[model samples]
Target: MSRPRPRARLTVLAAALLVGCTGSQPLPSTSTPAPVAADAVQDTNPQPRERLRDGGLLRFPLAALPTQWNPRHPDADADARRVLDPLTPEHLALDAAGRATPNPDFVTDVAVSHEGHTVVTLTLNPEAVWGDAAPLTAEDWVATWRASTGQVEGVAPVGPLGWDRVTDVRAGASAYEVVVTYAGVDPDWAQPLVPGPLRASTVASADAFAWASHRDAHYAAPFLVAHVDQAQGLVTLERNPLWWGDRPKLDTIMFRTVQAEAVAAAFQHNELDVWETGTSVDRLQQSRAAADTTLRTAPGTHGRSLHVSRAGLLADAALRRAVLMAIDRAEVGASDLADLHEPPRTWSSNLLLPTQPGYVDQARATGLANDPVRAAEALDAAGWVEGPGSRSKDGQRLLLTFRTPIGDDLAQGEFEVLAGQLAAVGVRLRAVTGEADLTPVSVPVDAFPLARLPEDVASVPAAAELVARVASEVDPVRRADQASQLARLAWQEVVEIPLYQEPQFVAVRNGLANLGAPGYATTDWEDVGWTS
Candidate 1:
């Protein structure tokens, strides 16, 4: 089963091409996360929508075509969530500082009350309507709660930490008014319910969010789903003819799915106007060679970690802990940051990013070290006898694969280092490369940091309680401290091991206004156009 995500946070996305492929999917089903910017976010080329050009085609490249159309579903990757953003209601918008503000287009007013628990009332915008021409109403929110909380059968609620807290959903006065009650004080109440007011009519069944070949959802945003060509691997979005808000600036936005290796070539050949050069020096260099391309740089909102697969040979907790013990995290961190302009820096806690306050080096605090000698001893104690170049236990060789994007030179380099380090400890590593290869042992997380820990970690004693505390804690100081404790538990428990924070690196065609390195700011589709 795919891992459940915490509902209070944004959907976790990979910062690399893994976002599109199977490698990003967790060993079970990958769910990653990013930091919520408590400080100034990496620059996103803020521009006045009025000053941008009126019309142009913004050709965007998605690492892989999005198959899952539902933003709230666990199968939805970064591409799916991003592609769906332009077609969804913006009840709450995250600002540069990661503060949630009510967008007047879909939510006319938001009033919160403290009636013992907590009640949040939302006044729906009468002007907002779905692609099927249904008005945005309270019924939609009620259905969303039912679907999101898994009250409906067969349709799995995407990691429902946020929705699980919702106790009641009913219309206040009219269909336009929505009243919500939560179990406790949720600091980020809007995150879980903001993404959808699922078209209430069709979401009652199991197949509502996903279809086998292609999927499409109802829309209320500035853009309309013009087409989803599964055979062609293209999703085209055009201005909504029924839009009642400000007119969109672009004629259309096309998301073309291409292989990881082909991305640079596509951008250079002018087939794509925007390219996400995910921490790969080779791809970044190649993209810069494109005509009029501008390289946008900012401290990344995402962090990379070493995720251990739960079902493989590494399933033995002792062996899993030994695998982490064998490698030098600092050496791996150096290679990941190599050739980049940002100074070499690695973080130990995924809960609070390095940019946030109350951050701590959980690995050191938990006593995880790069002592291969200790690792070898641990393996020996676990009954694996060390041989010339490998270890064996009951006829099984200590061998594993480190998967990466085929053309990712940076990933390959890191793989080489990881392989060599493990070899010294009598373990052999294989380099596996493919578009959707199944292990992103080293993937960057881009969502709510607190929600990104492997869902299985909750199985550990007090782990579930810690996660709940972190998610519900409203005070910044208390939350950070609670997150610090959880981070320590994640490391000590040998779940997903953190390495460091990555810088947000985006390479886009020059004059592409409002679209580069957005960091914490959500994309404003209507204002994103070329500056002719």
Candidate 2:
């Protein structure tokens, strides 16, 4: 499951702790001149677009590159694929479309053991080779486990949930098997192994695998540690000359950081081949309609939410419920200029199109309905009596602070709308435009006084686990139940109201081919091909 980055927490805290201490600066406009849609010479079967030719340069904008290049590491960022591609990479590597499927660029086949907790076998492409020409092998898997689990020294913790279950990881002739034995029978054991990668041979030895249970510095991916060029803000991955499958189309894949708006503008100017940030939906739609370029929109598993602070009267469930009812999600979505997002019913559901699997619709149906009448009544029942055109309880006025990212225009607009809605219910809603600080009152789970988050599903599981763990009673079943329950509640409470699914948009030159969208596990480099 996708997890939120630690930076997001810091961002929230920074907003709260430093509010009014600093002045808000408007983000520079990176809007681009609208491009004429690239001409589409009718291809009858639109399912498969022609592959791009080799040697073609694909330049795309990135917001930030990861300090760690390895995908298996806990701290790996979404952009890590630019440097290291995982074995059995998921289709549409960066985007979550469905269950991860094999990418032709990496592993050949993945086999799961029948017992469900024992073995997961991955057969690497016989031709697979690292950028440095070392054959990809079983040793890599062993190393990966050691590093991610903190079995080695001098490595950072892979955060809270380190890899501590696997009993053994061994490599066979052409296949590598990771035999995992959890503390107990975990039905979710299949998860950790599906996207397994070979550990770097340079760092830990086979014997180190036995020490995987120890939390040490072996948590960092060696490939990333060795190959990343931090000064240049670039990660260059040279083709594995010995790669078993067809050699990767690009000689070297370079991931570079650029401003989000600049990336959009670059796509319009044809300076970049792909741009992932979803900034201007109207411009993209208009451009595609005119045939300047192919515009493909897919629902993403990301979202945005308005955090409610539990300070003062908001600590009351009735007040929290009232706040939820006062805001109109549909209206906020309507006012959004970029149709890249939609009103999210629950934080558990994917923020983008057609809700996620196992998502329940009760949050939208009953919990957070835009009903001022019900909201006011709930407030009254909770001792918040409306008096002289205001709400109060025991002589204390009902007041709340809504915190959002300071410089984020999109969130600012959305929160402003929410503030106006809450005002009609005799509630004093103050819009605090700054960093989110939750340290003062030990931040309430249901109502965080501060909220700032990226729109990715990777973080969803963590949020869910936090919520479930807080309420869990049984120690043995605490984590599992917490995870599942959090996943369920993400949809149930609409904890983080998602606005839309954002897509990475790339603008390729006319002659480029073999460009398809990358899935959640794969990178853009996988789908790209350069035509003659």
Candidate 3:
């Protein structure tokens, strides 16, 4: 389950290769020339699609990739997993069938200390080289850790303070080692670290490991600062000829940005080889029927929920609860969208694995139910007098301003329906476009008692913690409890009403194999190949 990042505030600004195998069977190619008239064709045999050769080209669809390639920076995660590859990569990358495993492509082995700290040792293919032809080394790993941890200033923006817990990072003669010591017990310590390209010996000689921290000089990963090609609407990726693993199949991975609706059309017309966009159920069903493409469904890290501003009339807890009791969630879930959307039961729907440890069921009982009587009772208790058409409290009108992302048409439609539901209870709901700030007066993630909230509570635990720390009591236990309460309050108060879960749709050309959806926002692009 993934959560949507809050688009309201502008304050915080930011921000892969494969090998060969034994038996060494070549992948069948799918490349073909532009289709010609049936009578004008010379050869009847089907031409193979160009398989990933040492210098072939692959095209991928993108809404946007990161501008910065550095992984340690605060904005790095958005691009690190997709644009910049991870150095100390996770073992088990995706959990599809209850399987937690290591990523064999990048990580060789990992060891954990008694204190629950982890030291990940990485070994790249001997042939692997930096984009600059320098052999990747443990030194590069050390520099990446330093840059991300901000142990050495002048690197990319110092990542969030959470990175400070990394006690030590060292590169050995052979393998790179990263030791992460948590303030408390971190259940997931083996998460991958971003690997940086090796610095030139000349640069290294001048600054040693400190070279990576220098913002002025170009060390490695120059793609971070490179300009986007407006014509292509993409950031072109040239093959790293020095890369150790089997060179990428494509010479250049063309990443193009197109609207979600246009993806299926693009795939049908050969405008794209792969399509990645949040799709609606109707669109997904239509795409799945296309003869020329394959549809892959993966649970995305993006989650969808109704956001309520902490300011305005919604600040009242009683009014918020009244709003929560007015709408129907099941109806929203069933008719929300025609694509791959699911209804969210809690704020952690995107973060907590439903079957994983520490998951509590709080919203199971008070989900979206259409109960005008209960809604009226709650509003009455809050000093609201219900008139024929609307309700008023202390001469103040009961109203709310709802905000959501503009690109999400399905969400926009749901908001319209939700506004109508609230109107029955004498609540005036105004839907605002663009990002609106929802802070200070927000509800918990567990059960929203309020009808609307400002904060976006999704899968990112750190962000959730940040919200919890700021809005609730300050103790750790209390903070965690506050996080849970916020989640609950959102549902219970109907402050932050959940709309639906966004679905990630991947359109692949037929015959592609080993393609997996990104796990927890981390997509391993190296392992996928044309299987034929």
Candidate 4:
């Protein structure tokens, strides 16, 4: 099961937070292009791969490089996923409608049997091979299965929920054919090779699987790792000669690690080719000011969220309820959404976004709303006497401290709004900024919030069980119903609190193709190039 990051500092009554954009063969256009359709799938000037320019350096910036190239490694993050996408073999490909299909480049065909237990048969593409010309076979799947399941000594994967339940991995009729069997019905049977399986040699040793990993994410995709400059925080990928799929459009894709504050300057100075404008009006304005640039906007489920400490000062449910009620979700959303030109959208369920079907907005539900009057009354009933400026209970002032990063002007600004909202309800909110032990987290790519619970916990909320039930249910209608049930339970119990849905705002140089705020659509790296 996935769990929240340990170190914590920081969201809302409902709880929410941040995510976001691009650039550079400058087009002949003299003005910043108008915003594309305000919908889920944002624009990247979508064009055919044959039409895009074949050779150009695509430079971008990364906050940091993945500690390990292995996607299964605990240290690997979304950065690692992005860096490896252009090079790694994908067994499963997601379509425009978010449907998972067997990738013809790796697995040409797939068959799943739900007889007694779940068994998935994958026919590997005969042309698929490793950088060494070694045909990808069942051995790779076996290695992946072993490494992913923490049962193997000295091997630990980040999120191995579905993989851990896999019982066996063996060859089918031929080495190119593989069969995977699970202990029971495997809900995510297609995930055995979702991000692509690892080579047996690369993962045979625990050392290479973890800390000893290099930045070279060598795989048989469209590109290969060219060089890694650790001190300079730069990783470059070049066209892979051994790749059997469509040739990557760019000759080289370079990613340099730069701090958040320096990204705008880097992009403006032409040191960087693309940058995600995020919620920063300054960055958006700068991108709009640049010639031949287009701002792509899309409704996204991803955003920032603050994890409340259940064991801390506000351990009691009453205190937590009061805090939630005291928060003005609209004000918080407005603060985050101001420059993006999006209206404040509030949510109480963690898993269900307003755009999705079966969604129920419980932000204004009875007893759980942004009502300062009700909040003060709840606090008063909880034995916290309201003083002139603050509330005190048992000689202790009712003060809650919120910490944010020193340089994070966005967080600091949001904190001020949140502080003002709470003060009206007589709750003292202390501000702490600097190396906070808080995690400002982003939402999952699939839009489904994973159930974050202790592995050995004796009990779990009904909502968590519903999440599992929904995952296990095979029927579409039944699964949808269970999902609705899960969403209701999640909000009713605050299992995974959600504040607002973040809209994707990407700044791309005009003529760039097949890369933008592609909500739910997998990145087509081979088609990403300049159309000019």
Candidate 5:
């Protein structure tokens, strides 16, 4: 018989956060290029090789390099985190199926014991050592845990989620075995172990958040930061001589900064070997123009959606449900990428990506079909009398203000169409551009109603808590169920309307091998090589 999954009962409302991006070579073009078919050619996943090459240089692109390479530091930006990922040894890896797989180079096994409290044991490979020839022991583990959990004062960790619950860290049978006891159940024992020993020394410093050095202070993987030129926005990673695993297939990997707007140009100019952010239609067109480029496409993890506010006349639960029913989610997503090619990017679920396992169609399950008739009926039953342009109740008009990220034309267009859909059902949506602020106080504006109260921030507590729970759950089956539950709640409660998830596209030179879709995971430095 299987043990029953431990359930944590808690309630908290918050917003979901997502982060990340993705690459190729081509001849320079001087004249205006004709538009190419988006899907002119199909590409396949690169197959593994029976035998790999020993040395080559792979040129990659980064939007920018973080001032510091520390992943655990609070000040480390997204760019820094991207460049720092592969250089830091990974203790655990999430496979394509999202199951945690132990990295054989670092950890031999990971086991959790729950006896009143949760205890996690990490059995490291005795042969594992840092790039500096330092044997990774219990000290590194202890320091990393302490710094992340705030057990040490003056150190600001990135976040105190799983680490905060850790009660003790001690050496097990040997220095290579780490025993960590938590004050409460921590189902996510693998996540915090990724950076492993790479963060220990920097995290021990009092000013860890702002800590910067002329060079990498430590390294754990097969690559070491050999050079960083901030002025030119370049970072070069050289093969670590002290690597204990198989020697890397590449001699060096270079990350150069290229603005998002300049990516297509960079690829067409043959300045970058891999265009890591080639998702948009224009980007695909540019890659298609490059004869030697191979595009790798996958279902992306990040999503584009709208967060509705509960201020003004939208405080009623029935109205919230009505707005969800009235708006055509498919149409909204369609309008988002209308200018692009056919077959919308990919519809999204509030919980898991479509590519993930155990995903259920909660939008359909919760009866959120884009039917305006049912929506009007829901509002009518809720005592919102129909009026010109919008419905009203108690002398208050059914007016909603929406805010999307600034400078996003696609999102703006999506809201514009949604506003019309809602207007047809007697709900007026004011699509605006700015940050979403929920504070009641109003800031002065240069328009009518110079000062109006801010929209009330709205969130589904059950949905948010379920997401948190899903992250911590260890069992794959149970985690999937929890994820489905979260999605169901979000759709049912109309927490937020998930529009679509962008299909990830990575353009790379045809010669490059063994690199998966960008952002899927760190590149296998030991396996990535050139065919030539």
Candidate 6:
């Protein structure tokens, strides 16, 4: 099963082309050996390529083409953005744990002046320029800020971060220096600017945003679009001649749209250089079994939680609490694993992922784990009496309409197993297909500072108040304390039971380095090469 776009405190933050193949041929599938586990932590950091030669073709797969090449556009395609974001743009800094450091490739230095309104001065690399030879100067940054904020008519930002608090963005001492003056000291000011800048021309009007494409596009990164055969669902990128940085190792990189089910087969056949096997049990088996394939695993940064709708029978906190206690999150996660190498790890806190800092064991603190006796007590106290194969409160039957995305086999299995578990506890879980409620899932979070959190947790008022405290308080220890309090509040109310941080399994062919399971760190495109 493909992993859902993970819910991260920070937004989840992908290349190239050239002289490899003149024509595309349908890739033939081949078979290989049993998959096993890798020895190292799953990472996308540059690997040693000292024994490797330069210039080879790297092929991979994306699920689909992005509807729009402009990732900022409301209709931008997710798969396309996944590849385009890192390959064609420059950011002031790369996303990492703790404070994000300036990207020496794009930025020379960043300084802050707190004397008055929060003023930030960013110095751009003098040699950095767009593919079209236009200097990527402070003006481009200012244009991006203006276009993103909707200050430029017909343009709107991707989200409302701290940009509304901005007072001005002006050229500093030179064209390469951008001085931003905020209306207040906003801790999350760095959140919105990470996508780097839309070229000055692209941000000039609404029409220009739609002018970019996967086949022919302007780029500032180490790679540029070399070929795009949409009919064959293939995109190829080659080294960018205008790139000011070190030359990238591979001459070409290709992205072909491969269905989720077909990924394991494709990788086993040697059609792909790497596979991003996201929480798929079958894929895990296949990856482990593949001869010469190295498997990388890591603690996930995203949370897999049960999103309960307030309009359902679970509206009552007691009923929701009962359901949480009835289900064994460990079992549910293990079922998803189904004999995979790593055993499932139950999520303890809603606010922090297992790998992050400030994580507290709120699940234990709230005692929301599997306990049918406690579940029965909560149900009974809520006036739900046990009946034939189900429970009843007043005239209503304890039937909940559970939903998961269509075509998700793992979700289907999870729901089926959960239904049986709930049924054993006098509750009826009706597995139904419904549209995802994106409103509750898209809460913006900055990973490093933990500056902001979701406004509410459905009906939990205390959670909302606690999250507000987490957002405002400047002290890290105090923020962690407030976060723990809020997590405990959510758990007590059964706002959501985060099942497990889904493990990401990645398989890379031997000799390929600097590429694998991309985590928070931006891939250094130039460093991706092969070992001899």
**If scored against the real structure, what TM-score would every candidate get?**
0.70, 0.63, 0.61, 0.76, 0.78, 0.80
Per-residue CA lDDT of model 3 for 1-532, tens digit only, reads 1122222221111000111001112122232111111111111112222343234345666666554444434454443345444222332343331212333333433443323333333444343344455555566556555555545544543322234545666654555443444443332233324322334332233234332222223323212223357666775655443334433444455667776667777777777766553455656676676776777654444445555554567766667667766866555655554444444322333223232222334456345345778887888888888776577767776766666456766656677777788887787766666544221112222111111124444332344654534332212234334445555544554445544433346766775544534323333333334644
lDDT for each residue of candidate 6 in 1-532, tens digit (9 for 90 to 100): 1112112311211000000001122111231111111121445535654544779988888999666776667776677777785565536343323234456677655555444445667777788777777788887878877887777778774642556667788898999988887675544455555556767777788777664565333467888878788799998889888777767788898899999878888989888988877766667778888887788766544656677665557667778788888988788878877766666567766566654556677767877778988988989899999999789877888877666566777777788888888888898877667743111121222444354454345236746676556544433456567767887887787656677766656788887887776534456677788874
Candidate achieving the largest TM-score: 6
- Candidate RMSDs in Å, in order, are 10.1, 14.5, 13.8, 11.2, 12.7, 11.4
Query: In order, what lDDT does every prediction score?
Result: 0.69, 0.43, 0.45, 0.64, 0.61, 0.65
lDDT for each residue of candidate 1 in 1-532, tens digit (9 for 90 to 100) = 1112222222222111111111212222243222323544655567787678888898877877777777667788888876777876456655543445556667655665444555777777788787767787888889888887778887775643467778999998999999888887665566565455777765688877664333233667788778888789898989887777778889798999888778888889989887778776687789778998888876567666766666678777788778888877778777877767655457676465665545677767877767788889989999999877699999889888777776776667778888899899898988777422124444443344454455656566677888878766644456677777877776776776666667777888878887777656667677788778
Model 3 C-alpha lDDT versus the unseen true structure: 0.45
Superior by TM-score: candidate 3 or candidate 6:
6
Candidate 3 segments exceeding 4 Å error: 1-58, 62-101, 114-135, 151-153, 157-162, 171-176, 182-185, 191-266, 280-290, 333-335, 339-358, 365-373, 404-412, 432-495, 519-526
The order by descending TM-score is 6, 5, 4, 1, 2, 3
Evaluated with lDDT, which candidate comes out highest?
1
Local lDDT at 163 for model 5: 65
- Poorest stretch of ten by lDDT in candidate 4: 13-22
- Point out the higher-scoring one by TM-score: 1 or 4: 4
Ranking by lDDT: 1, 6, 4, 5, 3, 2
What digit string (tens of lDDT, one per residue) describes model 2 on residues 1-532?
1112223323322221111111122111232112111111111112221344445444545567665533444456666544344222431122132323344334444443424333444555444455555555677767666666657775532321324656666676544433334443332333344454544653454343333121212221112222445576654445433334443455555567777556556567665555443545555554354324654433333344454444455445456656667666667656554454443222323222233222333345345667888878878788887876578888887766656555666656766776677778887755665533111111111100011112332244457435424322212233323334444444433344443333434334444454433323234343355554
Alpha-carbon error at 303 in model 6, in Å? 2.6
Task: Give candidate 6's whole-model lDDT.
Answer: 0.65
Candidate 5, after superposition: displacement of residue 352 in Å?
3.2
Each model's total of backbone clashes? 11, 67, 64, 13, 8, 17
**lDDT (Cα, 0-100) at 374 in candidate 5:** 96
User: Model 5: runs farther than 4 Å from truth?
Assistant: 1-44, 63-66, 159-161, 207-211, 214-217, 229-233, 258-261, 278-281, 338-349, 385-387, 393-396, 404-406, 434-479, 516-522
- Residue 339 of model 6, lDDT score: 62
Candidate 5 local Cα displacement, residue 532, angstroms: 3.7
The lDDT, on a scale of 0 to 1, for candidate 2 is 0.43
Worst 10 residues of 5 by lDDT: 14-23
